[model samples]
Target: MNDKKITKESLVQMPHEDLAALVFNLSTIIQTQNEEIANLKELYKLRTAERYSSSSEQVGYLFQELEILDAVLAGQPEVEETIEVAAHSRKKRKRANACTAPADTPVCDVFHTEGAEDTMTGKDGIVYKRVEDKTINKMAVIPRKMVVECHHYAQYKALDVEAGKDNKKINLPAKTDALGASPSLVASVVVSKFDDHLPLYRQTEIFRREGFFLSRQKLASWVITYYEEL
Candidate 1:
């Protein structure tokens, strides 16, 4: 039989030289596979150590010395003392942002020119308001009531009263209905609900406090109508 066609049962009948050659080839293949597995495990360990390591491993003794220097400087007494410190200079602090008042903003000036007497004495001694400290503070002023517009249109009928004859009666439409709401008002309500996350029922209560009896159902209808028209 050919050597290529030999089975496990015919291995015992094979020549000693051919059997030794087959064993050597099988051993070489197993050794190559084992080396590949060991290389793969080593590469995995290196990658894991590089990626998952803690940030503290990067902090060295130099950073520790800087932190100790900062603490020692901060704990020093306010009085002058002959103490030696590391030659470390801190960066200058940045200035505050420049603030400009709006052109339309109304400015009201208040002066505290008058001084008051201090009756109580402190550890330093009695202190009175000698210098004036002027500071600017911005605040908002809410209106007592929201503006509600009312439009009135007068109607006149032309009659031939000279001949004592009456013409057909004509009625003119009102400038504003009982609802008396505007497009801007509806827009404000919709923005407050969606953008501000306010509910219609809460809006209704707010309107009630503002001296307007608004219903959530009406506001809901307005929202639906506004979207539908858009």
Candidate 2:
């Protein structure tokens, strides 16, 4: 018997008897390995089933079956029992009241005065005078409005150059060095960023919706400037 492993090239060169023996040994080894693998798979399935399977027994007859009831009441006496529950009363729910604005809130009065033609004339030929006014309070909101301020400076030129008066132009100095800086605009940005928790990019979108194209970078610079100044 040959002890060395036989390759395909060696098998082709071997004798007919040796080639037959090699084929038989290879087929037997493959069959044994397949059997071991199948046994391992079955053992693994059995172990998994045992480890995770529930220990409780399956319910045979849910206590509603006549056989279960007879077994349970084999030696017990029959008795009647009654249960009484107390009555409950539910409280009536209160309605929410309308909230009133503060006393200091600015009120805008809309007058609906009677015109001359619509004025009432009594049957006794007497004209009716205004006695009182009826007012209805309704909560109103004024949306934010974008406004552009145009500053025009008047130029003065000296008509008489012969006199000591030379051509000197004077205009009111701006509140700040910034070109379009306003208290209201800055306050709005600061409040929206800090109090309302709105980001500069979102505020830019909001401004775009209002037809004002303000870049997020410009808004960020303004916020930084105001933060430093404060």
Candidate with best lDDT: 2
RMSD of each: 15.6, 22.4
Residue range with the least summed lDDT across 10 consecutive positions in model 1: 169-178
Stretches of candidate 2 exceeding 4 Å from the true structure: 1-96, 111-135, 150-176
Instruction: Please provide, for model 2 over 140-195, each residue's C-alpha lDDT reduced to its tens digit, 9 standing for 90 to 100.
Output: 99997788877576667777786466676656454343536566787898899899
- Cα lDDT of model 1 by residue, 64-99, tens digit: 788897777667545533444588544444333335
Model 2: per-residue Cα lDDT at residue 144:
75
**Runs in model 1 with CA error above 4 Å?**
1-123, 126-129, 136-144, 154-178, 223-230
Query: TM-scores across all candidates?
Result: 0.39, 0.38
Candidate 2 matches the true fold with a TM-score of 0.38
lDDT of each: 0.70, 0.74
